[model samples]
Target: MKLFVKDLTVIDSSVLDYSRGIIGQSWLVDIVLHGDLNEQSMILDFGIVKKLIKSTVDELVDHKLIVPAHAKFCDVMSDGAFTYVDAWREHGESIHLACPDQAFALIPTEQITLASLETYLTEQLMLRLPNNVKQLDVKLREEKIDGAEYCYSHGLRKHLGNCQRIAHGHRSTIEILRNDERDSALELSWAERWKDIYLAEHCDMVSGSELSLSRAGMAALTPEHYCFKYQAPQGEFQLAIGKSIVEIMPTETTVENIAQYIADTLAKDCSDALTVFAYEGVGKGAIASA
Candidate 1:
């Protein structure tokens, strides 16, 4: 990690003011090195890095009573510096209006020191980005990994922390439908792979499910055996005698309604009555979009 800086580049303050209300308005100047991605580093996780930059910049602007241009200035150093540092002064107000190269005027210069900035910003971002961020070339490195790996906004994964993949994963925001214990049976209307399942009779005692039905058997049964009217016979039932671990001790035959039982059982396994409802809601919402 290395640093370089310059004065602010805002030629017009009115335009900046007009853009202030953007909820998550943020800006970063990526300092790219003439190099390639670190092969051994896997993917750069920008989740925490962005957070740290935000907090650090906020501290500089809001808390420290510094300006945005200045805030942006100091954030570069948070990523740490190696050799040469450059700042592309944004044509506006900055911490130090004039660099030593331009003119050698030495005074406090009305600019605040960045002593406490690093501690706070590093701490905030350390919670999310890779370790030793203080040593990385952040301005260039951080933005490149935005959709690569470790998106804190979403859960973590490799090659899939990307925005495209994130959209493919479960989204936390859709409206969840409300349901109850009474919704025991539902249409096994989706894929054959996802069958209508029921909560085990002794759900609390079961690790997951003692019943294991392969896609072949499930394919054989499906909407037919799972129909609300179908009933299991009076004798013992075995889904796969060929398999070593077979489903044992079948339930009462009066439990003729397999569909309702499956829906209700799925509800209990979720550990909440409305869980299946919420899950189904999300699934349907996804399909609607598709």
Candidate 2:
């Protein structure tokens, strides 16, 4: 017998990549189980499957930075309180970060992929399932929509909950309206700006001039790279990368703030009439207008 669940849950995460730096993504999950009928004449209880599988997925992957331990140009280390990660791009662009150990997952692989993640989840589920279960399957997928969606990463140091994790991120879709008419062009532009990008808090930025190396390197690098650090409820966190790849906001990076920032910024360049729909994940989000 086979039992299945569709649209099980959505996980927002970040993957460290040598070529793309840290890429944020959103994945929707589906699950299937093969087993003989249990005492209840069911392969598995739907309620139990929902509760058990959802909890497992959330505990392991949700709101975390997922990195591959064996990826080249990647180095990870840990002390008592924090996990330190160093990742370099193909061209030598790099990021050095430190956060609470609970903030990220160090998978035993060379890269992060749907197939690998599915395998890991299947293994975990197999261990937890009843003896009657003979096989488990996992399907990890991302939404397919042109320009409407994006994969991005961010940190919210001041947050009291899991958002305090510095490397966690989301895959979101954006919508924009100009003078109350849907503006696909404007929406696409904003999506492009944040695609695979990191959003940073302006107050947390460390001035390049303050660092001798950054100060010296600034002259040779266009747009320049900035390093930023902060302390959150989890622990200390750090992020260093090119300025062009980040959107440094004067306020927090919540969807509420993001919507307002987009509306306010576009109001200055185009017109005072604007509405921004900023989604943190699937289904619901925040809206702002000017």
Candidate 3:
């Protein structure tokens, strides 16, 4: 027998890429189970699939930084409670992160792709599934957007949950309105500005001497990089990313603040009012007007 669920949940995360540095992403999940019928004449209850399967997948990867441990330019270490990662591009541009252990999913692969993640997740799900379940299939895919979208990585020290992790991020879309009229040009421009970027807080900036990275992480730094460190409720977090890939924000990087910032920026040169709809990921976001 086979049981399946589509649109299981969305995993919003940042992945360390050998060439692109840290890239944010959001993937919708679909799951299938191949198993014999249980005593209730069912493969698995729909409620259980939604609750158990969804929760498990979320706990494994949602709001975390996915690291390709086997990548040539990637290095990972742990001090039991926290994990430190150093990932670099071929030309030496790099990103470093130190956060609580729960903030990362160190997949055993050379690259973090849909195929790799699907295989990794399937193996993990099988271990926790019931005895009747003989096999599991997991599919991950990105949301289809007709308009402008971008990938960005950021941290919220004020968040009490997994969002506090310094390296987690999202793939987001932007909508701009000038005098209540849709402005596709403005949307595309902003998306281009933030492509594969890191949204950082000005307050989080720190000197290289004050960074909490490993020796190799510090060695990978160049003059063109910006370093940031902060202490959240979870633990001390640190990062070093190339300056060209970072956007320093005067305020927090929350979707509410992002929308307001866009509205305020557009308001400067506008003779009329403007509105901005900023999406953090799929289906949910914030709106602001000026």
Candidate 3 residue runs with Cα over 4 Å from true position? none
Stretches of model 2 off by over 4 angstroms after superposition:
207-224
> Residue 190 in candidate 3 has what lDDT?
86
Q: Every model's Cα RMSD, please?
A: 25.9, 3.5, 1.2
Model 1 lDDT tens row, 17-119: 1112101111232321122234555234344334555444433332111222233332211112111111222432111111111111111222322333233
lDDT for each residue of candidate 3 in 23-50, tens digit (9 for 90 to 100): 8999999998999999999999999988
Deviation from native of the Cα of residue 40 in model 3, angstroms: 0.6
User: Would you list the C-alpha lDDT of every candidate in the order shown?
Assistant: 0.22, 0.81, 0.89
- Taking all chains together, the TM-score of candidate 3 against the true structure is 0.97
Q: How well is each residue in 10-122 modelled by candidate 2, as lDDT tens digits? A: 98888888788778888899999999998889999999999999988888888888988888778888776777777766876776666777888888888888888888888
Q: How far off is residue 122 in model 3, in Å?
A: 0.4
- Predicted model with the maximum lDDT: 3
- Cα lDDT over the full model 3: 0.89
Q: TM-scores for all candidates? A: 0.17, 0.91, 0.97
